[model samples]
Target: MQPIDKILRNYQSMIVSGAIILFCVIALIFAVIPSVQKIQEMFVQVSDIAAEAEGLQKKLNVLNALDEQTLRFQLASVLTAVPGDRSFPSLFETVEGVAARTGVVVQQMGLSGGTTLATPSAAKLSAADRKLGARTVPFSVTVNGSISAVQEFITLAPNVRRLLRIRTFAIAFPPDERPLTVSIEMDAFYEPLPTSLGTAKTILPELTAADNEIIERLGNMELITQSAEALPEPFIGQIKPNPFVP
Candidate 1:
C-alpha cells in the first residue's frame, strides 16, 4: 500500500541472496584457504620423504652389489693398514717378517717420533690419500742381502700390514765377499682414532675402478696373505741410537 513498504518487500529476497554470497566469501577466506594450505604442506612433506627414500635406496643398491666376504676383506685391509692406535711394535713386527721373506738379515732398525701431519706431495699421492685423514710415524731400517732380495723387499713393501712411504732408500756394496747392504728411511701412516678426530668422520666410499684394481693387486700379492707361521721367530735386536739424542 505505501511506497517504502513496497520497496522493502520487493528487495527482501535479493538482500537475502547477497547475504548468503557474503557468508560464502568469508568462509572461503578463513576456512577453505587454511584447509588448502594444509593440503599443500602435506604434499610437500610427502615429496621430501620420497626424495629421502630414493637416496637411501641408491645407497643400498651400491652396498648390495658387493659380497660380504669381499667387503670384510677390504675392511680388514683398511683396519690392519690404517689402524687408529700408535702400534709401533706392530710395525716392527711387520718389517721383520718382510725382511725374513726377502731373505735379508735385519742389520739395524730405528723408531722415532709419534704421528705428525704433513701435506702430501702431489706426485706421491694415491687414491687412499684423499680418503684417509691419517698421520705418519717415521722410522728407518737397514738390512743386508743380495741385490735381488733387496728388489724383492721393495716390491713387496705394499703388502705390509701398515702402509709405508719410503723417504730415503740407499744401497752399498762391500769390497769383500759379503751381502749388499740396504738402508730404508720409511714412514708408517695410521688413521686417527674417531674419538680424537673431534668433528671429523670417515665414510668409506664406494670402491672405484682404480680402487678395485688396487684391491685385486693386493689379493694377488703373496705377502698380502702371508701367514705368521711362515714368518721367522721374532728377532731380539736393537734399534740404532737416535742421532738427535746425542
Candidate 2:
C-alpha cells in the first residue's frame, strides 16, 4: 500500500463516523423535517374539522329539539305584528277593522313618507331606523265618530295585531251637532327578512323567555286581516306514473 492507503487505514473509523453523521443531517433536512411539518399541518386540519363538526352537532341538536308547528305559529304572529313588507292592504284592513269595531267611519286615508305600491328599501331609511333594523310607513286617517268611539279607536289602534304608533292626533269640534272628526297620524313598522343565510359554522340563536312572552301577546291580539295568498293544497291522490308530469 502507498502513503494514501496508510492514511485511510489510520482514520477509517473517524471517516465512517463523520459519513454517518452527514447522512443523518441530510435525512433531517430532506425527509424527517418535512415529514414533521406535514404531520403538524394534518393536526391543524384535524383540529379545524373537529371544531366545525362540534358546531354542526350543536346546531343539529337544537334543530331536533325545536317544534315546527309552534315555530310557525310564533313566526306568523311576529310577522303579522311587524310585517316583512309595507303590507298596505293589511295596514288598511287593520285600521278599518278598528274603526268599524268602534262605530267610526273612515272619512279619508292617505299614505306618506313612502309609496304605497312598493316596499321601501333600506337606503331610504334613516340611519337610526336602519340601525334598529326597522322602517316606518307614516299614514294619516280621518275618522268621524262619537267622542267615546274615537277614544276607543285610538286606544285599540296600537294594541292591534298590525302594530301602529300614534304619532299625533287632532280632534275637530264643529259648531253644528256633528260627530267628532279626528285626524290621526300613525307609523306602521316593518322589517325586511334577511336575504341570505349564515355559514354552516354560524350558531343558531336561541329564543329567550321575553321573546316567548312577546309572541304569546301577539298571538292573543286580534288578526283582522287574512293572508294575502292561501297555502297550496296538499296532494291527496296517488302519485302518477310519470312523477315529473305536473
Candidate 3:
C-alpha cells in the first residue's frame, strides 16, 4: 500500500462516515423537533382551555347562588325594554293639544339641529350647544297667546314623551300685540332617535339629501367613538395598524 493512496482512501472513508452521521443527525432532529413542538403547543392549548373552563365554572357557581328575583332584574337590565311606536306622534299631538286647549297660537314648532336653523327656531342645534344632554337635539317652540295659555302649556310640559327637560322658558308680551298676547320661548329637549338605541330614536328630523348624509356620518362617528371609548386604554394603542407586521 502506497502512503498517498492510503491517505486518499482514509480521507474518502472519513467523508462517507461524516455524511452518514450528518444524515442520521438531521433525520433524528426533524423527527423529534416536531413532536416536541407539538407537545408544547398541546400544553399551551390545554392550559388555555383549562383556565377558561375554571373561570366558567366559577361563574356558574356564582350564578347558581343568585335568587330568581335578582336574576330577573339582571335580565331586565341587560334586555332593553321595548319602547312604544306612538312615542313621536303622541308627543306631537300632546303638544298640539296643549296649544289648542290653552288657546295658544303656535307660531312655529321649530327644531334646530345639525347646522340647520329655522324660523320656528327649528335650529338643528345640539343639546350640548343648547346645553341639554352631552349630545341631543333641542327645539325651541315659540307661541303667541294669552299669558294664561302660555302658563298652562308650561305647567303641562313635564309629561312629555321621553325625559324632556325644560332648559329655557321665557314669557314676553310685546307692546303692540293684539288680544294681549304673550310670546313664549320654551326649550323642549328630545333625543334624536338612534337606529340601534336599545330604546328608540326619539326625534325624527326630515333631512334633505345632504342633511341625511351629514346625520348618517354623525351617527357613524358617534358609534365609532362610543365603541372606542368602551375599550380598555391598552386597546386604544391597537387602533393604529401595526406597522411591523402585515
State the lDDT of candidate 2 residue by residue for 14-85, as single tens digits: 999999999999999999999999999999999999989999999999999999788776776788888877
Q: Rank the candidates by TM-score, best first.
A: 2, 1, 3
The models' CA-based lDDT, in order, is 0.68, 0.82, 0.49
State which candidate has the highest TM-score: 2
Better of 2 and 3 by TM-score: 2
Q: How does residue 45 of candidate 2 score in lDDT?
A: 100
TM-score of each: 0.64, 0.81, 0.37
Q: Could you give candidate 3's per-residue lDDT for residues 176-246 as a string of tens digits?
A: 75533443333333333232323222232333788546434433321100111111122222454664442
Sorted on lDDT, best first, the list reads: 2, 1, 3
Q: What is candidate 1's TM-score against the reference?
A: 0.64
The parts of candidate 2 lying over 4 Å away from their true place are 1-3, 116-124, 175-177, 226-246
Tens digit of per-residue lDDT, candidate 1, span 26-145: 999999999999999999999999987777777677667869776766755555665554456667877888888888899999975443334233124334444444456678899999
Worst 10 residues of 2 by lDDT: 228-237
Score residue 232 of candidate 3 by CA lDDT: 14
